[model samples]
Target: MNLVENLVVFAHGKESGPWGTKITHLAETARGRGFEVMSPDYSHTHDPRERVAQLLALAPTAKRLVLVGSSMGGYVSAQACATLKPQALFLMAPALYFTGWDEEPQGVPALCSVVHGWHDDIVPMERGLRFAKSNHATLHVLNSDHGLNDQLAALALLFGDFLDQVKTEIL
Candidate 1:
């Protein structure tokens, strides 16, 4: 298959920087697959609005963009990409009902998939379900908690599958 000129950006979860396990793993995977990756460090700002601005600033306008956001970062990615319109969005345990963000989540005009842990206590899977439904996204429910650390291998596999799907459908 021809490799598309794609840029993958990973938005880390709240309290986690850009070098966390998820971000690192996915970045490596994307790189190994011949895709450029960016995991921006938003540790300086916890405010969702500020994060959205930061993420948007890093988004590339010249290439096909794929965004992967986790937890609060997922919220940032969702809001930032609403108008940016990337090729695909992969959200893991997105915090949708947080303060300073939109009360009602809007649909992203791109192929989007949401992966949430069923046992998540911090953000809860229900919020993911609601967001996915509202945005017409595919929701993947896993057997883990908010951090989803216990299921890294599975998450990586699912992410690989997502990239493959994007390769076929969007790239």
Candidate 2:
């Protein structure tokens, strides 16, 4: 994959920054695969809509686009998909179907994958299951919590595999 043609954009969770451990690790994985990576800071605002708007405004155009998000950022990435139309989407413990956020995603990319912690205390695993089932996404339920900090190595492997699948599909 040409670095100029492939891009992976990561949206961190509500409390996490752009360069959090997960993002940093995954960014390395993406870069190693010859894809340019970006993680926009959305810490200034807790509002999901604003984060979505910021991502839409900031994401650069690329021939092959992949969006990855965690928790609230997952919601942001999924919402942005209507306009961004990314070739692939990867989500971790996405906070979907929450009470305040009215705009649930109507559509997702064919190459969508989701990783949710079975022990998540914030976002229920059932939410992720429903979203994945409805969208026909590849879902992985792990034995971890909301942060999934303990499962970093597993996350990296799953994410790398997801990117590889995306690359294969595009080619």
Candidate 3:
């Protein structure tokens, strides 16, 4: 499979400052698979608009982008990538409605998949469903926790699968 050229990840529930282990791990995975990754720090679920701007700004090549987000980060990605038309996106336990989340994503880009954990605590699974439905995107449901750190292999495989689906395609 052709490796992605630009891959970006978003961190949730804190200012995870670029080097957060999950972000780094995923980055390393993408790198090992042959891709440059952008990991940005955003504080929790608050200020979705600003956070979205930060993520979008990091991508050097606008359309050939792969966005991966977890929890609140997933929400941020959904809200931001709604219009950017990235190459593909993979969201883990995405939460569309948060305590302080104010912005409503018009829609996610067609090249998007929002992953949900049926047993997530931080973000309910139904939220992911709603987001996927509104955007006319794909929804990948798993039986896991909020971060989905436990399902590392599955998550990686899913991302890789999406990469394969979008590679050399017209998205």
Candidate 4:
């Protein structure tokens, strides 16, 4: 059997490695499903937009990139929205401006899932809903605050369980 060994978990602005959040749990959950997940240690506090081009420059080498992002990381994921053909696009509390490219998206791959906290103060879920519609991305909402960026809150948000939902769609 082939091992599905490619996953990238990106953190939001000023947030870094492992993030100690539900995304980490989600990554751990995915490991049982045969995935090798890596959370890139990008600067969360800085303007991570410029970091997108950097990620895109390396897209060709990734085997089956599952781009996961939160807040600023989500903005970075948007840059990949047009670069590599990801196996799945998972955005958890991502910013919407990444979808700001001037040209219409060439083709949106299947299995695009976005999870947003309903009470998110940083990025309004209302705007996020519109972005998802434009890209035909699936939206999963959590009834919490932006604090879901942390592991405990993320677990409470049931992000770990959502891994199955993502896997089911992929398989």
Task: State candidate 2's TM-score.
Answer: 0.95
lDDT of 2 by residue, 59-138 (tens): 55688899999999999999999898899999999999998895669558999999999899999999999889989999
**Candidate 4 lDDT for residue 64:** 55
- Model 1, residue 4: displacement in angstroms? 8.2
Deviation of model 2 at 56, angstroms = 1.0
Candidate 4, residue 53: Cα displacement in angstroms equals 2.2
Q: Write the number of the candidate with greater lDDT, choosing between 1 and 4.
A: 1
Candidate 3 lDDT over 50-113, as tens digits, reads 7777766764353367777777677667666656566677787776777677456764557788
TM-score between model 4 and native: 0.74
Candidates' lDDT values, in order? 0.82, 0.90, 0.68, 0.62
Off by over 4 Å in 1: 1-4, 105-107
Badly placed stretches (over 4 Å) of model 3 are 1-5, 9-17, 43-46, 56-59, 99-103
Query: Distance from true position, residue 128, model 3, in Å?
Result: 0.5
* Residue 151 alpha-carbon offset, candidate 3, angstroms: 0.3
Model 1 agreement with the true structure over 104-160: per-residue lDDT tens digits: 645474588998998999997999999888888899899999988888888788877
Number of the top TM-score candidate: 2
Best by lDDT: 2
Pull out the clashing pairs in model 1: none
Better of 2 and 3 by TM-score: 2
The candidate with the higher lDDT, 1 or 2, is 2
Candidate 4 deviant stretches above 4 angstroms: 1-5, 15-18, 60-63, 98-107, 149-171
The C-alpha TM-scores of every prediction are 0.90, 0.95, 0.80, 0.74
Model 2 regions lying over 4 Å from their true place: 1-3
Window of ten residues with lowest summed lDDT in model 4: 98-107
lDDT assessment of candidate 1: 0.82
